[model samples]
Target: MLRIPTLCALLTLTPLASALELKPLALYQSGYPEGTEIVSVQVSSMRVIVSNSAQGQVDILQLDPAKGLNRIARHSLVAEGMGEITSAIFHPSDDLFAVCIRNSDGLKNGRVEFRAAADGKLLNTVEIGIWPDSLAFSPKGDFVVVANEGEGYVRDGEGFRSDEGSISLIDLRAGVAAAKHSLITLPDLAGVEGATQAEHKRLVERMIDGEELKIPFGTSPEHIEPEYVTFSPDGTRAYVSLQENNAIAVVDVLQGKLDKVFGLGTVRHAADILDDGQYAPTAELFALREPDALAVSADGRYLISADEGDTDPKIAKTKAGLPSGGGRTVSVFDAVSGQLLGDTGSQLDDMAAQAGVYPDARSPNKGSEPEGVVSFDAFGKRLAVATLERADALALIDLDQPAQLKVVQVVGAGEGAGSGKLAPEGLAHVEHNGRHFLVTGLEKSGNVALFELLK
Candidate 1:
């Protein structure tokens, strides 16, 4: 279930906002198993929780600068029967938090976990859809939405196909009751542009593995992977990112159904800037707008996305030219209509190169690879932060304007000034005590980098 649209959009630039500086606070090492990386970070009024996949648990830490970072609680996800923890979210207005764990059964099952934010006491556990990759809580703490990324490795007749992606809406009003919610699978995306059987067939027909991995036509929805989710301001609706499908799904929570699927068009790289994957200021690669993470705008009218296009190396190597997939832009879209509201263009890539932290080796495929995004307001400025995994950096963007986004800061992931550790994956904007913090979980170095956003 996929659709292909013929019309492509060309974007224009807008004025940028006044740039601000990001001050480095400190890098706290996650003292888990060796190579046990920190994948997600969530901050609350009192605690900073991180999901460590290697250790298969969530580590709670104290973020008081006077005493430095200290491990306060470590909850075992597996011990709690929740398998490996992929992500966690703190309740918007309460002293509680939720965790999304992948069930040991892999593509077959998953779970949602709840605990006290202050003490890390296990309060409840509920089963959700398969391969729950991310979690989000409504503003009033009435529900928890889980992104079940049922990956594409399941059985398809005699061969294998993708697991149909679904979203689990667990009701929090009846606290600790596992049966109070609903699970909604997305409607087949076969009608959305580029998701049709004919288009999918044309893609696989190219001999990468010696032959086209053929399947029945008109079955594109199975290729989708629900990667991330963000709720509408009132919590009545949800905007979910379908990373592999290059689309976003809208769901009406109370109605509990997959409402609409919006196709995110591809990005045309400037004259050879990214074609060869070398570090240059020319557009060489045309990437698919496969958003991995999303943040709802302050007004709830737009959906801010980090298009960290994930292209397989084996697939790219098979082509002589840059693949016709992936996009290296930070974009915004109308939430309801799914209209293109403009994007950051190549500003992020250009700035990263100027900061001397650009991953030249990774430029060809996904220049910066923005994996995580979170939005927060300070004073009057509407701001969002994205974790650039390959570049090992954090990029902040001002999102108050309608057609433009200003690059606020480029926090490096190195030993230089204003830097964090390497391979920053998950990001969160939080207030601890009275200070505003932009926290990141480093995937490669196994550390947590904290930045104080200077107003």
Candidate 2:
């Protein structure tokens, strides 16, 4: 049995509407089209990059946290009909940036384009795989990772989907001026020691659509989709979130080998999820945690994941908009040991519910839907900020005690109704003018909301 250690800080469940406050200081609006959305937001020294999916452009906005946004520049990653931008990130030094653009040629090809951070001029482009959802920079500024989520195609007759997800490592030992690009596919990561290959095969060992297969869901080791990647503090290793596969891949960057892939087994004891399709006020809990966005601790000791679950395109949507398999939780892991140290189970969902920011309509499968995550050291605490998409809220977690994680605060409607964000996605922590703050990208509303982290 997986023992869930109690949160020593949360000796008693504090009623939600009361906790640390997350005052929304500002919201910057961009006139991108309705279909086009701000899916990802990455911050630099004094600028912000927002990836416009439908518009195929990456906008570099001059950011003044106290003020709003100034559109300093923008660049279209693809031709009018060529492709679209998936995600973007700036180099550690803030001199250059990169964007992963997926070609429109049947989701067949993708590329990582390097550009000048200030002028947004194209420097170079390197070929990668299909459907790159997210990317990241190494802390040492020597490499970048592109998570190519190869979402398969389907025909009317074909019963299952393709599993061609992968990750591309762009080595900049010689700098972006001259770089080497390499791929680390799901198949490559499968056999590593810490990986869950054997157990995953056993659990998924069944037939699908009358066809006898190694795994039932067309999701085997090779199909393990790479959704997001975060680097360790020292830049010697990285962790990739396989959202659908329910696994995390640890790569040794310096050695360029698979260090290990920690299999995050299903959440079996979650006690706060909404467990019915009625979208009722009543609530219960179940298990099944599939994480999306992930981050590493400053000391490189742990990894934090936002367990926002997902399903296939072939799967029908419910009235509540949830996947059949999902655990409304936040999980923490021992990076090197690949041991699941602890998780914030349905506590996040319970927090959202009490805050009244919980999206009842998105119950059962995705209660809070913690998506974007970022970590930093704040006031002597190893802290993390999680963006709850369905709940339209931001949560601050006290990670000082990794084994006994606590919900230090919840920012949502209960505290300040209209001040809350809607469908928040990406999260970034920043320090400027000797003050701490958080910046997030709001997808549904196309707004960038900023909050001052009051100590």
Candidate 3:
């Protein structure tokens, strides 16, 4: 069973003449057992769906921005030979959602399941290979594209290695996985020079586990390494973030081929730069780091990529790498032109250093690392972002005036007040009747916080 909490205080939000009025809708926490982690959230007109990776279940909660929060329904999925739920999203116009679950034992085989949004009823399931990270639906809602994280373990001459990663194209209309593409191939690394044979071998070995793992023929020249996938408003173009390669790959949707790759900047060794210059090297890591969470504006004019700092031991083992610094930061880009549009929110180091919470430069919780960005308002004026490491806060970015962005108004999840103590993970705008509200999933506390957006 799921639990819903009542809001003790409801503040009437006044709208700014140009901005929309925002208010606190009800907030509800998931009913999973203690220690269960809520990984992501998706909101539909009638319900808000929360998924727990640790519990291996997806809970459906009734949302009433005007009345308060309520858990109308809940359901647990059969393990389906996968480990946990990594990502999920509701179908644009239906009560169905798609989720990607990776294998628990760290094998390459994963699964994608389609379920009824209202009751959490299992509708269909498909087995996939490797760790699938993100899922995006095609414009017509006919296809779903998955970004596989690939294999994690490698054999150093003793045991069986795990190298599984690739992207699978599932035909929703046909209810089957139509095509699978390996992202570790060289073509995926086009325009990337200095990629050595050892790196290629490492990438290949990291994608599939055994000697039987061979590159597929007729695979498009596009390199894999895809982390998060998003589509344009009209679904005409698909933008994929290639975290390992430090670039975003734009794909020609209809043709299903890589059109271009946008690199963030130069990479360098960590020890060479001074403290003042340390941020430069760190900033390079942001550009080159794995882009984890991705969002497209409602109008499809902009694409935002949230880079989760270096978590890989292998990458961190490099002398140039510093312990993943400051919380995370976001990069906004022109979806069409592929141009960079500055960053949103503060970096982990800046947040930690500013808060005086951690005196050491190598402190772990590195204050305020921003993680995910979901969507902009219907007018394309405001953006809602999630800060995973930075307590509970949703960053609102003003698009009409780019210079005015990053001026955030922290709401709900009272980090200072002590009412709530969870980091915000996923965010989305939910509309009831004609009013707009912001919904955020608190990963640490296993709950969802609702806030009204003021104009």
Tell me the spans in candidate 2 whose CA falls farther than 4 Å from its real position. Answer: 1-12, 15-20, 33-44, 160-163, 188-216, 219-222, 269-284, 312-324, 413-421
Q: Against the true structure, what is each candidate's TM-score?
A: 0.84, 0.83, 0.72
Q: lDDT of model 3 at residue 2? A: 12
lDDT of each: 0.68, 0.67, 0.54
lDDT of 1 by residue, 110-135 (tens): 87778886767878878888888887
lDDT of 1 at 342: 78
Clashes of 1: 31
Give candidate 1 misplaced runs (Cα > 4 Å): 1-19, 33-44, 65-68, 79-82, 152-158, 194-219, 271-278, 313-323, 414-421, 431-435
* Stretches of candidate 3 exceeding 4 Å from the true structure: 1-24, 33-44, 80-82, 158-164, 174-225, 266-289, 311-327, 345-367, 378-380, 415-421
Give Cα distance to truth, residue 363, candidate 2, Å: 1.1
Question: Tens digit of lDDT per residue, candidate 3, span 1-455?
Answer: 11111222111111123444334556675764322223333434556666777676777666675566577666677465547787777676677777888877664577788888777777878776577777777756776777776645544475434443455666566543343332322254544532111122222223335443333211123224567777787776777766655556676665556576665532222211122312222333322344556778777877776655433332333334332222245666678776666664443333223222212222222223456667766444656455444434555445554433453443434343112256666666666566666666777677777776665
> For each predicted model, how many residue pairs clash, with residues at least 3 apart or on different chains?
31, 1, 32
Tens-digit lDDT track of model 2 for 4-35: 22454233454333234566777666675222
Q: Considering lDDT, which of the candidate structures 2 and 3 is the better prediction for this target?
A: 2
